[model samples]
Target chain A: MTGPGRPAAVTGIGLAVSGLGTPDDLLQPDGAEEAFDPATGLTGRAMRHKDRASRFALRAAADALRDAGLLTGATFAGPASRTCVVVSTNFGNLDSVCTFADTIAEDSVLGLSPLGLPHTSSNSVAGWLAIEYGLRGPNLTVCNGGTGGLDALFWARAMIAADRADVALVVGVEPDTAPVARLVGHRPRLDGAAAVVLESVPHRRSRGAPPRAVITACTHGAALPDAVRAVRGTDRQPVGLWLTPAGPRPGDAASSWCATTRDLTARLGECSGALGVLQCVAGVSYLDASGPGAVLATSADGPDHTAVAALLLTAPGQAS
Target chain B: MSCVITGMGAVAAVGGGPEQIFTALCAGTSGLTKLRAFDLNRYRAHHAYEIDDRTGPGRDEPLRATRWLVDAVEQACADGGLTPAARVPVLLGTTLREQRSVELWWRGEGEVSAADLHFGPALRRRFGFTRTYTFANACAATLYALGLATDLLDLGMADAVVVAGTDAITESAFGTLDRVQNRTPEALRPFDRARAGMLMGEGASAVVVRRDGDGDRPALARIRGVSMNCDAYHPTAPDPAGIAAAMHAAHTRAGLGPDEIDLVMLHGSGTELNDAAEATALHAVFGDAAARPLMTAIKSMTGHTLGGSGLLSLIVAVLSLHRGVVPPIAGLTDPADEAAGLRLVSGTAATAPLRTAQVDAFGFGGINAVAVVERS
Candidate 1:
């Protein structure tokens, strides 16, 4: 693998999970609730036929821009052409897909709503995020396995490094609907969204936004140890903390490499698409509260997921 | 570092491989026929460009798109003369991925797991690819995936990447298209004066991309650049300004001017709005150039393969650049008024000393993606 490019600064964070007061709540031992209502703060006739995941995405994106000091009221404060959006959701729009299928089965082809058709397209969340905030730069949707969240963040970092965009609004959301439950066997999953404003150093500095954390490296590989090794590269200093999908096992190689390890899945339930962003938010919080440390975020390995994506986060102005 | 396509493969209604598809296009073959995926009764549109039973009949065996994808990827690997490596990443772009399988399960006609909705599980099991990324970026998904694949190579994340797009005709998308079009033409006639609307098609296309100097394989074509953007306009409507922006970005990144482009593969979904809007955008982008490129749409023959359409067009563009010939837009009785200044190839394949080409894919939600390719 090539050497890591210039670090990307995390300037803002947004959360829309049910019963969480803020992103910091993710660090708690338990969550408030397991279910979310899509109509909590979404209003107006524009949201008439919007799906639950799209609504969560819009809410989290707006909050992220606002948190980044790039949005005032309903207007975006940054250059629209240079700002992009990258969204991650494994099963975000299952409800809409199933609903449309049922509609066709119950009635006929003509019975389907034309307005509802766009949501069935998997990119609707990213499209809606861009349209709502007028982000005209590159737009993409990552719908892979559990690694999708980190994949989305890695894409944003790659885009910024390639000069495709100066700022990337990365959002990961998955809804807990009946159709999704039926397909996945009702395993408790996060029914909300988590977002982060990842920007180039110059862009963040120009806006005078304080960096919450700096992503020194992001790598994807066949396994977690290899990915973590790639992230660390030749740097021998062990990471201070590791926020992983599941807690470290007794014989895990990472536990010996890092000082502390926390299971994000156990603490926050099944975050799924929101896992990577939540890990970043928690990393920022940990660095802000403590001082001078690195946090590596990773997803759990599964038979369906043959890949592992890792993100290395360090405190502002600190080496990873 | 420059990215080049080492090998390419495609599976459409008209043909199975790149050479076969290109030959079929040069022969003005059309793949449109009566819709056999579902009951056509009570529907105004009764036709679609569908693959035959070679992959098995529709609905009876779900994951039809996955089958096509696997076939295309295997062909691409063989074409490149490269063995599957553990580090090779598979980047797949799809709209309605295996949603057809989900639909079958919803109707109690098949068994599908949540993991089966994507191609990762199937691909991992078959090829043992370590990392696979699936992008469901609507119709423009394939080109979008190409952009990421190029990035992965540039970033040294992988030695090479397998970029593929696959989609089967799903009932929901078909019903939605039927409702939106009101009536589907017997054949999709993109840019035609009497063109009605687009018909859904099923197929898969793949290309193995790597840094030019990284491997010893002969390069089929050089990928100059791939760019994508959101119109941030209406969800289902085409935006000329947005489309033009993506085209300009692609050209700028490729370091090529509009005059240098010899051919363009239009999105050309055969819909009235798409045709007019795409033509307008092309004019806006190439307005200052002295000679406009010869533009053609393969969807007129292959039909709209949705997510697979972009790479399908790109594969054809690569062949055109290599062969120095352009395929005709099949069944074009008369061109529309908006295509007045555009040089659209019709009737039969035309020869030109082509050096560079551009492929455009504009999708729902105003997602626009463009890619520039050149002869190796």
Candidate 2:
């Protein structure tokens, strides 16, 4: 097991999103088409075939890889370096699944799209990533409603700790479809995605890479606060924070605790699984400036529910 | 770091639990019978190993597959002398969540409810477990669950973990299979030149996992290692190269070479493609040793229980270790497929002390899992 104090460094990241298919596009939002939502906090170009979930995941994964400077071939140690990918989704292509149901209704035993059947699966994104990057180690797609993203991160940390993979890609994506919106009994909101590349602290130190934020601990389920207290003890120097859509807003006494994109999107009735990625991006964006010790919490309400809390501790001297 | 299998339970076409199923398997009694669980009027092949429909304490409810899974876990925990209230983590694997319920909902016979989606949570609640997870990786789900549980235990995540899987063939999924042309009406003939498609079966299996510790049971067996790999070749078809990632990883983790494997429990679903591909993969790993290891397929008796097949096969492997007997590969008569090379046990059971065994499970989405077990 990874020791309590020993950090798991975010060494490489990748993300892709709506209106911004690459990191360059996300970094310079003006370069792409204006993607904004007045009802919800989501802003992106609308595509018929590409739903909010896919758009969120694509962007988040691309940006995460870019943030860690892993997009280009020059960043990798070698072709053989083991990389694992874990993507989380709350609804898991709810749009496609609903569509499959509709198709079955229309043609009792006749026609069903071959492509749509596979696309509706929760692991479609993980399968896409594995095929896209040739990542052959430990690909997993986890669904725990709101905590999906945080759970993915936790699993990635475990994989790294177990020496299963050298670098891990953790992505979370959610969709804002009408069916999803209706199911959640909310209006559509902007869907989002986030990706984080994690590695052992020693490997990051050896690579001479700029000290990235270290994940000290993660807590899940209803007893998250207890787990968080157990991990953090009395230290409370968080400069910026992100909370789940339903999480209570942190008091003003703390530093900047901005509401996540999910909080905005959930209001607009979006059920996108990538909401956590957007929140993570926002959290990282804050920390990249003057923020430090940011905490992110993503919560989902469903039958198989979850709440994930992540603590990002900037390395000493690297705290912005 | 050897991971021990302290306890196991299973429900197959033959009967409920391991002993009953093994007895039926040894007797060469086929579990294939006319499908009476549901109305399959429009379907072609109707035979299935339908569990008795009894509920309330002793009855196998139509939804009893999941209930059976819980019972199996409870039985495994009891067999291992672990308290029911113990807070052991759980890892469950299945292809679909109560597929029968889904089919009923699809047919407009019932409402789409939380019970259909909350199978994992229901299991967690039934077992009173705090840390529980579910994996739906097609046929390789249970093996992956077992492998992950072992990994977690080795990493000191939990003292004891429960790995279980269940799947019940519902009419809708059966119809889908019929539409896809993947189901065979009559018998399952693995590695047979005249082999048709696979016959879908329904069943559940589970194993109690723990770190190698003090145990006096002479029948105990150890899980050395497990490996999973994705072909990325095709969503349904396996890589023709006979990708040996899973086999290699299992061998490496078990600290054993291919030559050391005494037996192989293949995922011989009786499908032409699956059997051939598995044969090729086995040959690639075992080389000249391929012809020596005793190879068998248990799917003929239990049917292809989708996600539960992996764990069910593992249970059979453990039983082999315990009983010192390897059952025959049921339907394969002639040596039609020489490419499978491995010694295909047939006719009757072979009594031999198996030092090490390998089990393989491959899913529809290019997911491949393999685990190595050794006599303790």
Query: Which prediction has the highest TM-score against the true structure?
Result: 1
Give candidate 1 regions above 4 Å deviation.
Answer: A31-39, A247-253, A301-305, A318-320, B54-59, B288-291
Two-chain DockQ for each candidate model: 0.64, 0.23
lDDT of 2 by residue, A1-320 (tens): 21224457765455444433332233342445544332333344422234456555655565566666666652333232267777777555556555554555456423554444344344556665555556667766665445456656667777777777767778877655655555554644445566877766666666566645666666444344444444454564443455446453344632333432225343323434455555555444444555545555444434444323444434334421
Instruction: Indicate the worst ten consecutive residues by lDDT in candidate 1 chain A.
Output: A246-255
C-alpha lDDT of residue B84 in model 1: 77
Docking class of 2: acceptable
Cα-based lDDT for every prediction: 0.84, 0.63
Error of 1 at A17 (Å): 0.7
Over A261-282, each residue of candidate 1 has an lDDT whose tens digit, in order, gives 7877775566776788778877
Candidate 1 structure quality by residue, lDDT tens digits, B127-149: 98867888998999999999988
Q: After best superposition, candidate 2 residue A155: deviation in angstroms?
A: 1.4
